[model samples]
Each structure stands twice: as C-alpha cells, then as structure tokens.
Target: MRITVADPAVPDVVALLSEHLADMHATSPAESVHALDVERLRAPHVTFLAARDDAGDLMGVGALAELGDGHAEVKSMRTAHAHRGAGVAAAVLDSLVDAARARGCTRVSLETGTDAYFSAAHRLYERAGFVECGPFAGYGEDPHSRFYTREL
Candidate 1:
C-alpha cells in the first residue's frame, strides 16, 4: 500500500471520514466526539493523508494538525472496515508521525474515546509509543476522553 498526503474532499476520503465521524458519535457522547469533518480536515493547519492499495483504492485515512509551539495533534484516524486487521492504521499512523517530524514538531498528541469501543485504538497508540496524558489544545477534563502524547 502507498501512503501520501491527500485531499479530504475526495469522494472516497469523504465517505471514509463520514463513517469515522458516525462511529465516533455512536461510541461517545456528542461533546466527547472530537473527530473533524471534511471541511475542518481541509484547514490550513491540518495535513490529511490517505493510504491506498496498489490499485488505488483508499484503505485508510489520517491527519496531523499543527498546534504551534513545536507540538502537533493527530486527527481523524480511521482504517476502512475491510482493511482493519491488515496494518492500514499502523502504516497510516507511522506516516502521520513522520509528517509531524518533517514539520518540526517536537511532540504529537491525540485524544480518543475511553471506552471498550476504543480498546483497539488504545493498543495502537501505546504500541506506537504514545503515553497517556492530560488534555491539551483547548480540551478539558472529560471522563469519556483519553488523551495521549508522544515525543518526536
């Protein structure tokens, strides 16, 4: 699979992000769901990426948002359901980390759900070297949110 910067407005990417938002909302309270929509992902501070197969079908999507002060945030990470166990998320995650490093970010942080529905995501971040941390970038104490940070 190939991973590269992509436009979130593309049809397939939009569909994938829509599903991601839906899942986030379904699994968490409205205020706890922080996944960005297509328009937000297109912001100047965010770099959206897509992982595609050899035939060019999108397999997953992830994004990095520059937070200034040598810090960045991971946003909208999701692997297509059919491609979940195939390392799509891992590959996309590594790419996003690399992108963050390239942008001179000294640290990368993310927020995910703190429920059984997010067990896989928790494992993924931990395996990638992210450590649990307090909320950052405007987020406050939230029982349903789990925050993580990794130094680049």
Candidate 2:
C-alpha cells in the first residue's frame, strides 16, 4: 500500500471520507463524534493521509493535526470496510506517528468512541505503544470518548 497526503479535491478521497463520517455517526452520538469533516481536514493545521493499493484504490485514511507545543492529535482514522483486517489501518497509523515524529511532536494523542465500533482502533493503538490517558488539547471528560496518548 502507498500512503500519501490526501488531496481534498480527489473524488475517491471525498467518497472514502464520507463513508468514514457516516460510520462515526452510526456508532456514536453527535456530540461524541470527533471525526473531522473534509473542510476541517483541509485546514492548514491538519495533515490528512490516504493509503491506496497499487491500483490506486483507497484502502484507508488517517490524519495528524498539529496542536502546537510539541503535541499533535490523530484524526479521522478509518479503514475501508472491505479492507478491514488486512492491515490498512495499522499502516496508515504507523505513517501518521512517523509524520508526528518528523514534525518534532513529543506526544501524539487521539479521542475515539468508547463503543464496540472502536475496539479495533483501541487494539491497534495499544499494540503500537499508546496508553489510555486523560483528554488533551481542548477536549473535556466525556462518557462517550476514550483518549489515548503515546510519547515519541
């Protein structure tokens, strides 16, 4: 798989992001859904990534939003449903962490849903050295949210 910064104007990227957003809303409450929309992902502070197969089919997506102060937040992570369990999410995640380290971030964190829909994400983060942590950045304590952080 090839991972690169996603172009917001690309149709495939747009559709994949739409699917991702629908999944988040399907599993989490409106207030609990932290996934960024295409517009937010286009902000200068965010670096959105897309993983694609050799044929250029989008397989997964993730983003790292620079939070300043040596910290960054992982955002909008999702693997194509058809590609689940094929390691696409892990690859995208590893690349985002690498991007964080390259940008001089000391810690990277994320806010994900606490529901069963997030189980795979929790497992992926844990295996990659992330640990449960209190919310960082502007986030507050919420029953529907689970936070994790990892030091680079």
Candidate 3:
C-alpha cells in the first residue's frame, strides 16, 4: 500500500471519514467526540493523508494537525473496515508521525476514547510508543477522553 498526502474532500475519503466520525459519536458523548469533519480536516493547519492499495482503493486515512509550539496532534485516524487487521492503521499512523517530524514537531499527541469501544486504538498508540498524558491542545480533562503523547 502507498501512503501519501490527500484531500479529505475526495469522495471515498469523505465517506471513510464520515464513517470515522459516526463511530466516534456513537462510542463517545457529543462533547467528547473530537474527530473532525471533512471540512475541518481541510483546514490549513491540518495535513490529511490517505493510504491506498495497488489498485488505488482507499485503505485508510489519517491526519496531522499543527498545534504550534513544535507540537502536533494526530487526528482522524481510521482504517477501512476491509483493511483492518492488515496493518493499514499502523502504516497510516507511521506516515502521520513522519509528517509531524518533517514539520519540526518535537512531540506528537492524540486523544482517543476511554472505553472498551476504543480498546484497539489504545493498544495502537501504546505500541507506537505513545504514553498516557493529560489533555493538551486546549482540551480539558474529560472522563471519556484518554490523552497520549510521544516525543519525536
């Protein structure tokens, strides 16, 4: 699979991201859902990425959002259902981290749900070297949110 910068507005990309947002909202409280919509992902501060297969099918999508102060946040990470368990999320995550490092970010952080619904995501971040931490990037403490950060 190839991972590269991509536009969130693309049809398939939008569909994937819509699924991501829907899942987030279904699993977390409205106030606790931080996943961005397609328009927000297109903001100038966010760099969206897509992972595609050899046939160019969208395998997954992820994004890096600049948070100033040499820090960045991972956003909108979702592997297509068909590609789950095939390392699609891991590959997309690695690419997002690489993009953060390339932008001179000294640290990368992210927030995921703090519940059984997010168990897989928790494992993914931990395996990627991210450690649990307090909320950052203007986020306040929330019982439903689990924050993590990794030094670049």
Candidate 4:
C-alpha cells in the first residue's frame, strides 16, 4: 500500500469518513463519540493521510491534529470495512505518526471508545507504542472512552 498526504475533500476519502462517523455513532453514545467528519478533518491544524492499495483502491485513512506546542492528536483513523486486518490501518497510522514527528510533536495522543468495538484500535495503538493515559488536550474523563499517548 501507498501512504500519502491527501485532500479530505476527495470523493472516496469523504465516503470513507462518512462510514467512520456512522460506525462511531453506532458504537458509542452521542457524547462519547469523538470521531471527526470530513469537514472537521479539513481544519487548518489537522493533516490528513490516505492509504491506497497497489491497485489504487482506498484502503484506509488517518489524521494528526496540532493541539499545541510539541503535541498532536490522532484523529479519524479508520480502515475500510474490506481492508481491516490487511495492515491498511497500520500503514496509515504509521504515516500519521511520522508526520507528527516531522512537525516536532513531542507527544502523540488519541482517544477511542472503551467498548469491545474498539479493542482492535486499542491493540493497534498499543503495538504502535502508545500507552493508556488520562485525558489530554480538550478531552475530559469519560468511562466510555480510553485515552492514550506516546512520547516521540
């Protein structure tokens, strides 16, 4: 797969983001969900990355948002339903981390649901060197959420 910084307004990327939002809503209560939509991903502080297969099929997407000096948050991480377990998400995640590191972010953090539905992501982040932590940036403590951070 190939990873590239992308324009969130692209059609396929927008569709994937829509699916991600739907999944978040279905998995977590309204107030517990933190997934960002296409418009939100376009914010100036955020950088979007896309993963595509050898055939150029959209495999997954992930983004990093500048929270403040030397810190960033991972946002909108999602592998296409058909691409899960294929390393697509991992590739996108690594790209985001690399981008964050390049931008001088000393720490990278992410928030995901605490439910079983998010176990895969929890494992992925753990394997990528992220460790569970208390809420960071703009988040508050929530029993339904799990926050993680890693120092670069």
Q: Clash number for every model?
A: 0, 0, 0, 0
Clashing pairs in 3: none
lDDT by residue (1-152, candidate 1, tens digit) is 99999999999999999899989989999999999999999999999999999999999999999999999999999999889999999999999999999999999999999989899999999999999999999999999999999998
Per-residue lDDT tens digits of candidate 4, residues 1-152? 89998998999999999988998999889999998888889999999999998998999999999999899999999888888899888888889989999999999999999889899999999999999999988789999999999999
Estimate the lDDT of model 1: 0.95
* Alpha-carbon RMSD of each model: 0.5, 0.9, 0.6, 0.9
RMSD of 4: 0.9
The segments of candidate 1 whose C-alpha lies over 4 angstroms from its true place after superposition are none
Give the per-residue lDDT digits (tens) of candidate 3, residues 1-152.
Answer: 99999999999998998898888889889999999999999999999999999999999999999999999999999999999999999999999999999999999999999889899999999999999999998999999999999999
TM-score of 3: 0.98
Each prediction's TM-score against the native?
0.99, 0.97, 0.98, 0.97
Candidate 2 is scored at a TM of: 0.97
Q: Whole-model Cα lDDT per candidate?
A: 0.95, 0.91, 0.95, 0.92
lDDT of 2 by residue, 16-123 (tens): 889888988999889988898889999998999999999988898999999999999999998887789999988999999999999999999999999997898999
Residue 34, candidate 2: Cα error in Å is 1.0
**Lowest lDDT block of 10, candidate 1:** 16-25
Best by lDDT: 1
